[model samples]
Target: SRFAYVRDFELPDRLLPGTFILLRIDGHAFKQFTDAHRFAKPNDPRGLELMDHAAISLMREFPDIILGFGQSDEYSFLFRKSAALYNRRQSKITSILSTFFTASYVMHWKTYFPDTPLRYVPSFDARVVLYPGIREVRDYFSWRQTDTHVNNLYNTAFWALIHQGGQSKKDAHESLRVRFAWPLL
Candidate 1:
């Protein structure tokens, strides 16, 4: 019962104008990862279980939103936050911490596997060095987070969706300018 599969996936039409634009900062060069190893296989017993855990965690944190979740050696997600309660300032604080934690996790991998081209896992929209043991732990934690779902901090799906429409960093800046300009107008 570690993992279950949903055979079909359908996107609601409203989201066409707004999808969680997904991107991944894969940690392929990290020391602890390699392409040769496996707990079982891709979509095999353990991998599937891990994916299930991650999905549940993301879903629980943003119950009303649709998350485009995927994982390979690394993980990625996207969500819409139009209805979220948190504002830009508080959200910014969490984003900084989230980056720190994610970076720490990736760097720690170097102590495990020394060499491999794990820079990307296009098939799964993932990017990391696949280590069975690490993945098992990661999956377990992901599942645990679901049972103990937090409030705004882990609602990454919502953040991703709000960020998707911008064309570049500059576009993002321009968008914010317009948003703030709205009240004045």
Candidate 2:
């Protein structure tokens, strides 16, 4: 019991009160993982569905989470402003949600990909952000959605250049760079 004082070294990590808390989780090194597992280009329906299922499971488990937004290999969960879960502890909330989502993804993998075998375990990284009001929350989600749309468009064009236009990887990148360049001659 003498060593219990070590607990005092832990810093206080409570989130701001009267603020909406968002826990966002993203797949770590998922581009390589997806490539290794041969996920469909631009987007994979199975992977997206699996992420949605995992998010739904988390929402069900933590009723305080009011909304979830997901695309590609990332998801954002928004908690009610009045939620007192874990006393709004940052580390506790993020760690639990990340672990739960990752476990749920692995557990439900077979259901989504019955024919494709899992090559290796997948993991996710998480962060907790606080928004002072509903407007900020809406802006955050809008930013994420816009990011998804822009990324999808770029990836589709990149892949199309490689597969359809017979461009090498480097050439495809160059093509996109030129196309995206400002003040084109």
RMSD of 1: 21.3
The global Cα lDDT (0 to 1) of model 1 is: 0.37
CA lDDT, candidate 2, residue 33: 90
Q: Each candidate: what lDDT?
A: 0.37, 0.91
Most TM-score-accurate candidate: 2
Error of 2 at 28 (Å): 0.9
| Clash statistics: count for each candidate | 7, 0
User: What C-alpha lDDT, on a 0 to 100 scale, does residue 55 get in candidate 1?
Assistant: 50
Badly placed stretches (over 4 Å) of model 1 are: 1-37, 41-44, 81-85, 88-185
Deviation in angstroms for 40 in model 1?
Answer: 3.3
Instruction: Tell me the lDDT of model 2 at 154.
Output: 81
